[model samples]
Target: MIKKECCYYQSSTVKDDPEDEESIIKGMTPNPLLKKNEWGWAIDPIGFRIALKEIYARYKMPIFVTENGIGVREELNENKTVEDDYRIDYLRAHIEQMKLAMEEGVDVIGYLTWGCTDILSSQGEMKKRYGFMFVNRDESDLRDLKRYKKKSFEWFKNVISTNGKQL
Candidate 1:
């Protein structure tokens, strides 16, 4: 009889050495020096790249980014649209890092955003919205249930049309 064990590592942040002061001064500083979401998660693009490198080195397999997006408190404007430039910026930075990883010989297969349409969060919080399309609803009140394209919608459309070249 043979026994095998498999371990899966999933994290947004990956460090080579946590206690090495020299390594920390070289590049790692324990945490990302970037913006945070409503849930206090660091929006660290550099960390994403580092994680990609680490995973590829370990598994030597193509990586697929299943869920990556920012959750924010969103509201529609008078024109019935959300100017979610922040989301666009977040996606752009992460995509740029992915490209860097690919350039560095990481076999990145696919990249998928968290949500295309506003949906209930994993914690069941409606206020923490993550989507290019805004759904007309609230935590307690289900509004018209209409969907409105946010500013990032068209931007992402362009990104797709160009196959990320425009981004």
Candidate 2:
């Protein structure tokens, strides 16, 4: 539910909450004080891109999409493979939009997505996962932290191998 409710690349309709985020940055609010993990509202990349264009036009510096992705659960099958199509879809959409943004004259440097492997959870639920590499070990079972490439692994490999040209 948290993942579904979170919108990392929402359009202009999203109400800007930079002021609310200021309190978090200023330590007036407890860590993760905001609703769910939406605490990083000030770090909205879509909003940042719009701001960057103004800076780029004035100073001509390279812009960057520093973060973006969908978080989800990953449990390995007996065969040791992970299916992470959501992450792939998330990146693919953002990349397409980025291409359009660059074509429209934004000097973007690169996109750096978060989390390459499964991580421990905040809510202690074993299902809340986000990674291309799946770790067999969950919050409950410290089983040998086995790893598996997710479905996006091949797709991302092809895109990166082609310098994002194939994408």
lDDT of each prediction vs. the true structure? 0.81, 0.61
Which RMSD values do the candidates have, in order?
6.2, 9.0
Q: Extract clashing residue pairs from model 2.
A: 72-129
Top TM-score hit = 1
8-36: candidate 1 lDDT, tens digit per residue: 22223446766666333444443454566
TM-score of each: 0.82, 0.63
Per-residue lDDT of candidate 2, residues 44-162 (tens digit): 33444455455567666576655566556567777678766756766775677667668779887777665667766556655677667787786678898777898877888888788
What does the lDDT come to for candidate 2? 0.61
Pairs with backbone N, CA or C atoms under 3 Å apart (clashes), candidate 1: none
For model 2, the superposed segments whose C-alpha errors exceed 4 Å read 1-60, 121-126
